[model samples]
Every structure is written in structure tokens, then in C-alpha cells.
Target chain A: MNSLLVSLRVALATMLVCVGGYTAVILGVGVLTPDSAQGSLITRPDGTIIGSRLIAQKFDKPHYFWPRPSAPDYNASGAAGSNKSPTSADLTDRAKQTVERYGATQDKPLPADLAAASGGGLDPHITAHAALYQADRVAPARGVAREAIVALIERHTFSPGGPLTPDRLVNVLELNLALDRDFDPTSSSK
Target chain B: MTAMVFILLIVGGSALLSWPLGRYMKWAMDPDETAGPGRQKLDRIFASIAGTLGTEQQGWKRYMVALLIFNIVMFTVSFAFMALQQHLPLNPDEMKAVEGSLIFNTVASFTSNTNLQHYSGEASMSYLTQLCSLMWLQFVSAATGVAALAAMARGLAGRKMMGNFFVDVQRATFLVLLPISFVVATLFLFGGMPMTLQGSAHAATLEGLQQIIARGPVAAFVAIKQLGTNGGGFFGPNCTQPFENPTFWTNAVCMVAIILIPMASVWMFGRIIGRVRHAGVVFAVMLVFLLAKISGAVWFEQAPTQAFASLPIEQATGNLEGKELRFGAATVPLWAVLTTSTSNGSVGAMHDSLNPMTGLMPMIGMWLNATFGGVGVGMINMFIYIILAVFIAGMMVGRTPEYLNRRVEAREIKFAAVTLLAHAFFILVPTAVFAVTPWGAATLNNVGPHGFSEMLYEFSSAAANNGSGFEGLGDNTVPWNIATGIVMLLARFIPIILPLAIAGSLAAKKPTAQSAGTLGVEDVTFAAMLIATILVVGALTFFPAAALGPIVEHLKFMV
Candidate 1:
């Protein structure tokens, strides 16, 4: 009877320790708020609502802005990364194919990160170079003068030092929203 | 490529140094223990405590069960921690908790001594989550291993009042892991794994909007991850990041810490059983195998890959896949050798970057399960093989075999063979299945021979209970997560269970001293025989697969 009591006490003690420790961890990670999430709004052509700051959707009209690579399904809940290693041949070939599809010349140097997917596959921004490549095509579609679009870019481009070429980049999501209001009021991409 | 070289470098040092250091540690602790005053003091104190606690001596069978139960409890704790992370505190960034399917794999990986990682370190985990769920379990899992080590000592030393499970675990953590982890963890922090959950790196990308980069409390977790021989890194990049394993000293420290327990505990085992030279012999054979591989990796990586040279790309740099700038080519292989040899999956080099020939060393190491393995369990596992080697030699010579002063028999050998075959099966069958399947082929990070090598390396790592990968496998998929989890469970427990059962059964055996006809275990001949057993039986099994993978790659690059 005494032995049985000791065994029970030990088993109980083990269970309690495990439960207590486990609870501390669950509360530690699960309860935390996403306070750092940066929220932004999209204004439609008439200055009404659209969607989010980070999500990526299609830019259908051959005249609109393009978003960076995203693994998420337009910010769907079950969205996930392709889970491919950066060194994978499949990814390397895919990146190369994408570059070719963008009509980049064979000799043009591509940004390393541009060719590789982000670990989460939901990277929201592209280098100024990537944006600039699309700028020529996008400006012609909107009937906006090159200098005017470049000036809007100059105002919005972020840089720690003073003005620089790569520094005058624009956010795709924000830029697209601005395009909807400024011209093409009937644009439907949200 | 840089990380694989770092691994090569470490293997060079560990292979040359571990045996001598192991031998020295044996002599340093006690040259001729006529039973020192300190030993007596520890003994008396423990005995008194046991008496007061009303501890009853149980047979080895019951003790093994107790140890397994303790391990299961640890498993439960880690899993619960993962599930509950969402509601828990210390999440300053307020990151959402991990999903359950991912949580199951993560918990199993950490607890089973295989540290395979599938998630990003900074974004997915909170500070409270990192320390409590992952780091805390590292502590208990390491302690559970050492408790089993003490049980092995009892089996050999033939103690009537075998050591307490709780006491052994507490002592291992308090005396070994906690103190060492404090110092090592601090060093890793000094090397720049983050200690605080201060604001993450802030910036705007070329776009005017603010972009956030992932950073967190990695320094504290890194110490145990490396020291416990758990290679699952604090961040997704594993050890390649400057913050996680930064600088040369920290690199060396990580290497040293991974092998410390496995190396030092051999001396501890010798001391407990009163056979210093016996431990030295086992340590020596392991060193020879390790050193040869390290040199091979170093040589292999310095040579340029054939495909890279043939491509119009500049061929000056060697083996560049997934290689980080911080450590460069030489440092990668050094980290590789240490991680694989110690049951750690922590990688400094991208296994994808390794020269095809270079990948073989780690693949072989994981395939055989390092002779000295993860922390406490590693050294004990080596001893089980030594006993089996002795029994085999004795049977061949038509003599009764004795380890220390115990008879070897069919029952003991049966359990050891089960453990051996189970471990071996884990390495071979998994690699074969992956090789024939599209799931494995599609995940290939590099093409040709090295790709197959990386898949084999993953199985070798998982089955050996080492968690570090070649960083090549697309391990995030469901098949890998589930399959590797099962392998980790079986590989870890099977090795542990059989050794423990042997200990229990051996405790029942009456001591039978050696006669003229009986084989002598103490002499140099027996030592040579033991070395042969490890190299021939353990290593030879993986040779053909290695030839197909790393060896094939070597020939390709040369051609």
C-alpha cells in the first residue's frame, strides 16, 4: 500500500511538471499579438476602399502595376511556401524562366534575391531595378508622362541618404491604388 | 560551400584531438582511484538521501521503464508547449502560434534527439516560446539521456541500490548541462545570437513602405541547441547566420560543445567501471574514422565542381550553393563534421553547397550513428557496442567473454543485435524509398550525384538520431515531416531501450572472472579487435551507398 502510494505520487508529480511546463510554452507563443503588423489602405478610383497593405493580387489589364513574388494565395489562411530550397535546380530554372519572360536580355545582371524566393514566399517588395523595368511599360499604358510618374516616385522612394536612382522606388500595392484613382476609374483589381 | 568547409575543418580538429583529450580526461579525473575522498563523499551523501527518501532498489527492468516514462513526459511537455504558444505570454511581436501539424513534427524532432527544423526561427516563435518550449525541452531531454547513462553505469558497476532517476537527471542538468550551457550560451550571445527581444531591424525596402526583418532571442537557445547536440538552429538558416553562430571562437565553441559531453562522458564511464584504457580504445577508433573524412571534405571542397567550371560563370570560387559569406568555404565542412558526428543537425554549410565527395563524411557519420553521440546517450551507446564486440570475439575464440567481470551470453547479445539492426534499418530502407520516389527527387537542391547523397544524408541523419541535414531536402512537405518524425521516434527509443534492457539483464548475471581459456578484454589485442569491429561491422555497412553518392560525385567532378 505504501509502495503504491509512492508510485502514484511520483506519477502525479511527473504529470504536473509536464503540464505546468507545457502550459508556460503555449501561453508564451500563442497569446502574443501581431503588434508589429503594418496596416495600410487602398483607395479605389472614386477614393473608396479596396484591400490591404501586404497582400498581392493580379494586375490584369496589361496597363497596371505588378506585385512581387508571393507564396500566399492572395493572403488566404491556408497559403504556404513552395518549400523549395534556394539551391534547387527547379527553382533556379524557374527564376531564370521568369527573367526571360520579363524580356530581360541574356546578359543583364539580375538581383540575387529577385531570382530566389523568400523563405516564406510572401515577399512584398522588389528592388528599384525590378520596379524600373516595369515602369516604362506601365507609364505608357496609363498615358501619364514619364517625368510625372518619376516625380511621384521621387516623392515616395525611401532612402536614408539623400536622392539616389535605386532609392526612388514605389510600393506596388500603394502605386496600383494611386493609379486606380488618378486614371482608369473603372479598374477592378482589389 | 563555406559551411561545409567549416565542418571539414572541425572534423580535422575533433578527429585528431578527441581521443587524446578523452584519454587525458580519464587520467586527469583520477589516475588510480583507490576511491578518492570526493567519490566517497558523493557516495555517502547519495546513500543517506536515498535512505531518508525511503528509496527501494529495483531491478534494471523497472529502472529502464522509469527512464522511458520520464522521456515520454518530456515529449508531452514539448508538444503541449507548442500547442499552447498562441495563448501564452512574452510575445512582444504578437506573432500567431504555429499550426498543429507543424507542432507535432517540431516537438518530436526536439525530444527524440533529432533536431530537424521546418520553420523560420524569428517570425514563427516568440521569446517565451523559444526559451520555454524548445530550450526547456532541450534541458530535460539532455537530462533524461544522462540519467540513462547513470543507469548504464549501475548495470556495469553492479549496484544493488541503483541510482535514482530523478537524482541522475537533476545532477546531469545542474552539474553538467546548466552550468556549461550558461557559459556557452553567453559566448554565443557575445558572438551575436540575440539575447533580448528588442525591436527587430526596421527599414524601408527600395519601396517607400516600412519592411520588417525577422530577429529574436536566439543567443540563449543556441547554447543548448549546439551543446545538447541538437542542431535545429534558432533561425531557419541554422548556424550559417552571423547572429546565431557568429565569429571564429563561437564557431570553435559550438564545435567543442557538441562533442564535449560525448567525449567527456567516456571518461566518466571508465571511471565508474574502473577501466580508463577501455574507454580510450573506443574513443580512438571513432577518431580515425572522423579524421579521414574531415581531410577528405577539405580537399573535396577546394576543388571546383565540374558543372560550375563548364558553365560560362566565373569558376574561381569553389562549391558555392547556399554558402554564407560570414564563414566562407573552409569553415562550412568544419561545422558539418561536428554536427553529424554528435547527432546534431545544426549546419554551418549548406549541404547543397558541399562538393559531392564532401557530403559522404556526414552521410556516413549519420548512417552509422556516431560512436560517441548526442550528449549523455552518445557515450553510453558506444559502450553497448564495445560489449557486443567483446562477446563476438570471445565466441570466435571458443572462450567465455567478460566485460569488466561479467559473463556475455545469448540474451544480452540478442538485445544488442536488435538495437543494432533497428538503427541500421532506419538508415538504409528510408534512403532507398526516397531514391525511388518523386517526392525525394523533386526536392533536389543540387543535380547529379550530390543530390542523391543529400537524400541519403537526410535518412542517415534522421535514423542515427542526428538532426542536421544537408540543408538540401524540401523537408517541409507532409511526407517528410511524418516519415522523419517516425524515424526519429524509433531510432532514438530503440537504441535507448535495448541498451537499458541489456543493463537490467546483466544486473541479474553472477560475476564470472576470466581464466586461461577466457578472452582477455584489457590487453591491446582485444583493443585492436574492438577497433576492427567498429570499422568493419559499423562502417562497412554504409560503404556501398557512400560509393554511389559522395564517391560518384567525386568521380563526376574529376571527370
Candidate 2:
């Protein structure tokens, strides 16, 4: 009985060791990477800070690339999706909301994924096909000719191995950053 | 959708793998079975260094303590390696530091054969970090699995003490890892997996010359990662890499290699115990489940998903989203089932894209704790469950349970039962709540029954300590990250805890005399009874989730 109790203690010690180890590691990270009360502010070429990586801002403008739609929205730190079964009413409701959101985005209806999220709401890219649907609206909105817009869209399309649905896309975060770098506001539509 | 199905296939395929390997072990471990010259050299080395020091006759509690301490130390070191990777000598390109949370998950995951990865391989970690921290764990964890395998082998072999924990861990590493890794790694390198740290040539992205890409020492780690049944990747994109997974044949070979030793331990079981039929029964049972899930996935693949149904994608080629064109519907799940179902937790095909029902298959495998395996531990876990089942069958028949001189007494039965029930309790109760609750419901990525099923499946898989995801659960948040971490720890240890208790109690019990009323667990009757008990328990526990997830989702897609 004493040995059993001792064994129990040993197990508890082992568990504690694990817990303590993690706590220490976390503390180390806190010191090294130091949690910021504020997220790093990013900006357009205009020097105006837009937002932070920690925050998910809605990108509905035609000229800006879009991210995967989020449930509970794409913002809210540590926010997540409803773990609903495919047949549940909750999902249908959410989809309906997403569909409505998608409808407001452009003349064309939304891509299914455009209205949904990649499991980790942290997903940053939209599929090319989904991205291209926005090209028409963005081309005119930016006063860039449709052909030039098409060319930029073509430039962003990528295939890693041309395998596994080879259409996995340019991440929205990187793509938007590129837009800020290359797009010149002084260009005339004429 | 492709990711999810591949997960199921790999899981189910892993189960199928256990059988042949089990049968082979049965043949190989016999004293009468001739060791080829090479095997003799291998065996000799294990004998010398492993020292066979553990009193195969030591009492159970002591053995359990040794095993516990051994694993704890291993996890600690593995965790430290990740946390301290920047300081580690081997790190190339000064790999970025892994967040403690990711380290916590991988350490817990790999030790448990769960192999859950929160970070993308290339983006988050360096080659040195992958090798020392991730790859080292893969090797040692495989040893840990075989250690459990050997412990269970002790119970079956009718040893008095639970056997030497150190010997088992060492021999498993040497006897299994050294040779198996050689074959597997060589095959991978031959199959075009790269071992060098030279960055993959930067090429134009489909649209244009884009980001400077990173590829790593994939060949070396890819071999052990899968063959060791450690499912982490050289690159975060994982087995999705052409360099890592490569051609379909390479994927198949790697998949088979991972399960082969874990499954072979069963044959080792029969030989060590001098009972060929006993090993065969376990091997057979694992096969049945594997085949069932594999076929289920194939059938599901042939059917188009609603998401696809709404799209122009052809069903003939199967759902392509998140699937590697190299492996196709057939190979990915075969690889997936092999990886996730065995505690390998590695992914060659993205499980994020699987149709809800097809996706549920691997979830089922993980939820089962891949009882058929985590390389070494899978066979051991099933054996422990078998003991519990035998004890139950004996109770129902108004007799005592006796196997190889160990009495399956009331105490042993109680603890083992607690372990089984506790695991089920964890999976089912949480799943039921998630299905019913608003918070859980709001988390669904897909709508309809299929989406809800995925949510339940994700929690179940995590809670079960199986790391494969539906890729549907929007995890990485506080609620899930914390809940899952807790679940993974519990799922990994609780089963181990009760078994060790059972071993202790059995060690203390006097061998009961065999009589007409004593149940012979090795007979066809007992084996069949055991199988029925396992299925019923599994079916009863998981059927609701299965109905809500895979069964409902399958009908939705097919009908």
C-alpha cells in the first residue's frame, strides 16, 4: 500500500515535472518574445497605420485581397468557429450570414470557401479563382484597365507542386502588402 | 476534403498494416525460427548494449515506476530540445524558436504517438530544430512505444515481474529502430526525399517569381518520422512535399514502413509468449477495423461532396481540394490512416479538405487511440484492453479469468474497466455536449449534419490524444488549445495509468488454479467473445457521434 502510494507520488511528480517544464518554457518565451499589449501597427505607403497582425480587419474593398471568412467574425483575439456538425442549424445560419456577407462584396456570388474559413481562423489566403472573381470590380475601382488587372491577377496565381489541389493561393496578407508596394495612385484610367 | 479522407485512409491502412507485421513477428520471434546472418548481428548488438538487465522477473509496480520515470524524462528532454533549440549545436539557419504552446503539444503528442502539429514546418522551425528536437523524439518515442509493447509482452509471456523497462526501451530502439530506419530511410532517399539542408531552388510561383522558398533535410527525418510512427514533418507542409512524400509508391512504402514494426510487435508477442494463435487473433481484429474504415473511405471518395456537388469538380477523380495529385484518393487515406491511426499523426495528404463523413473515419481511428497501434504501444494497448475484456467475459460466464498464469481478478478488472470507461467517458460526454451546446455549435466550419459531426470529431480526436484533425475544427484559440492540451495529456496517460495498476494488482495475486470453470482466454470462443465485447463497447460509445458525423455525412453526400 505504501509502495502504491509512493508510485502515485512518483506519477504526480512526473506530471508536475511536465507542468513545471511547460510553465518555465512559457515564462522563457514571455521574456524572450515578450507579449505585447499592443500589436505591431502596419501602414499603406501613405504612412497611415492600418491595423495589426493580431487583429483581423474586414477587407471588403474591391482593390484589396480578401481573407477566408471567419465565424464570430475574423477578429476578436483567441476567437474560434462553432464546432457544429455539417447538418446542424447553427452551420446553416452561419452560412446564410456568410452568403449575405459575400453578396455585399461584388456583382458575382461568393466562392464557397470565400464565405468559409480555413480551419484555423488564422488562414490568410484566398484561392486564385476566388481572388480573380474580384478582379473585375477591383480593376475598375482602382481605375486600372481590366487587362492590367488581369495581368496582376495572373502574376499572383501560384502552384507549389502543381499537385494536391495545386490551386492553393497567394496568401492575402502578402498579396495586399504587394499591392501597397506596386500600385501607383497617380495613374490615369485614360 | 482531400485531407480528411487521406487521414481516414492512412488510419485504416495502418490497422491493416498491423496484421501482417504481427504475423511476421509471430514467425520471427520463435526460438526455432532461424535468424539470418544480418539479424544475428543485429540481435547480438542489442544483447550487448541493452544488457537484458531488467529482471524480466521484477514485480509489476517497480516496472511501472521505471517505465513512468523513463517516459517522463524522455518527454522532458524532448520538450527541452524544442524550447532550447536556438542554443542546440545542430540547428542550421538558427531555426526560429518554437512557441512553448506548440512545444507542449508536440511533446505530449509525439510521446503519445499523437503527432499533432500546430505550426507549419518550414515557416516555424529550422532544419536543426526539426532534426534534434522533432526527429530525435520520433526515434525515442518509437522506442517508448516498443517499450510498452515489451511490457505487455511480459504479461502475455507469463513473467513474474513486469520485465526490465530499460531493456525493453533499449532493445526496441536498437532491435527495431536501427534496422527498420535503415531500410525506410534508404528507401526514402532512393525515392527522392532530400537529406541535405540546401534550400530548394527558388522558382517562379504559378503567377510569377515569388517568395524565396525553404525546403530542408527532408530525406533523413521523413524516413524515421513515418517508419518510427512519429508523424511530424521535415517541412510544415509535411508529407505534402514532393521531396518528402514524393510519388505514390514512395508514399505507400513509407506508410507501410511506419506500421510494419508496430504491427510486427504482435508477432513478437506470439513468439515471446509461445502462442501463435493469440497474436493472430489480435492481428485479425485490428485488420477487420482497418479494412472496414478503408473501404468506407473508398466508397465515400467515389461519392461527390456537397461542396463539390455545387462545383464543377468531377467525382471520377474524387475530391481534389487539399489532396495531393501524386497520391490520389487511393494512396492518401492509405497513408493518412497509416499515420494518424498509428499515433504517427503525420499527414501526406491534407485532412482539412475531406468530406465530413470520409473525414470522420480517421477521427474514429484516433478516438480508438489507434488501439491497434502507436508503433510499439498500439499492440500493447490492445493487449491491455484484451485483458480487461477477458476479465469481463469471465464475469459474465460465472468463472475466473486466467491467462498464462495471471489472474484477471476483481481488482484488475476494476482498474482496467475504469481505464476503458474513463476514455470513453472523456470522448462521448464532451462530444454530446458539443453537439447540443451553443458554444460548440457556433464553432462548426461546415453547415448541416456533416459540419457538426466534424466539430464533435475534432474534440473526440483531441481528447482521445489522437492528433489528426478533421482540419475542419477552427482550433488554435484559447478555448480549444487549452481544452485539447488537457485532453491530449489525459488521453495519453490515463490508459497507461490503469494498465500499470492492473499489472501491479496482477503481480500481487496468487496464480489461481485452473478448473473447468476457469475461462481460457486463448480459445476461439474467448477470442470471438473478446472481439464482440470490443465492437459493442466501441459501437455503443461512438455510434452517436458516428451517426452524427460520418454516417449522417455519408448519407448526405451519397443519397
Whole-model Cα lDDT per candidate? 0.61, 0.58
DockQ of 2: 0.05
Assess candidate 1 and give its lDDT.
0.61
Q: What is the C-alpha lDDT profile of model 2 across B1-559, one tens digit per residue?
A: 5545544555456557655655544333322336567655544443344344322345666666766666676677667767877777655455667766667876776666566666656665655566555666666666666666566566555555666565555555544565556666666655555454443333222122222334455655676777676776665446654445655557767777766776777677776667768777777777667767766666665543344333222234454444444454466556555555566666765565565556776776766654456766676567666886787776788766776577777677777677777777777776676667764677656666666665666666665555566555555554555556667677766776667566566655576676777676567776677668767765567777678766776685556
What DockQ values do the models have?
0.04, 0.05
Q: State the weakest 10-residue window (summed lDDT) of model 2 chain B.
A: B202-211
lDDT of 1 by residue, B99-187 (tens): 76678778888888787776666658776667666776676677677667667766787664456664455456545666566677656
* Model 1 misplaced regions, further than 4 Å: A1-190, B1-56, B205-210, B312-316, B437-451, B516-518
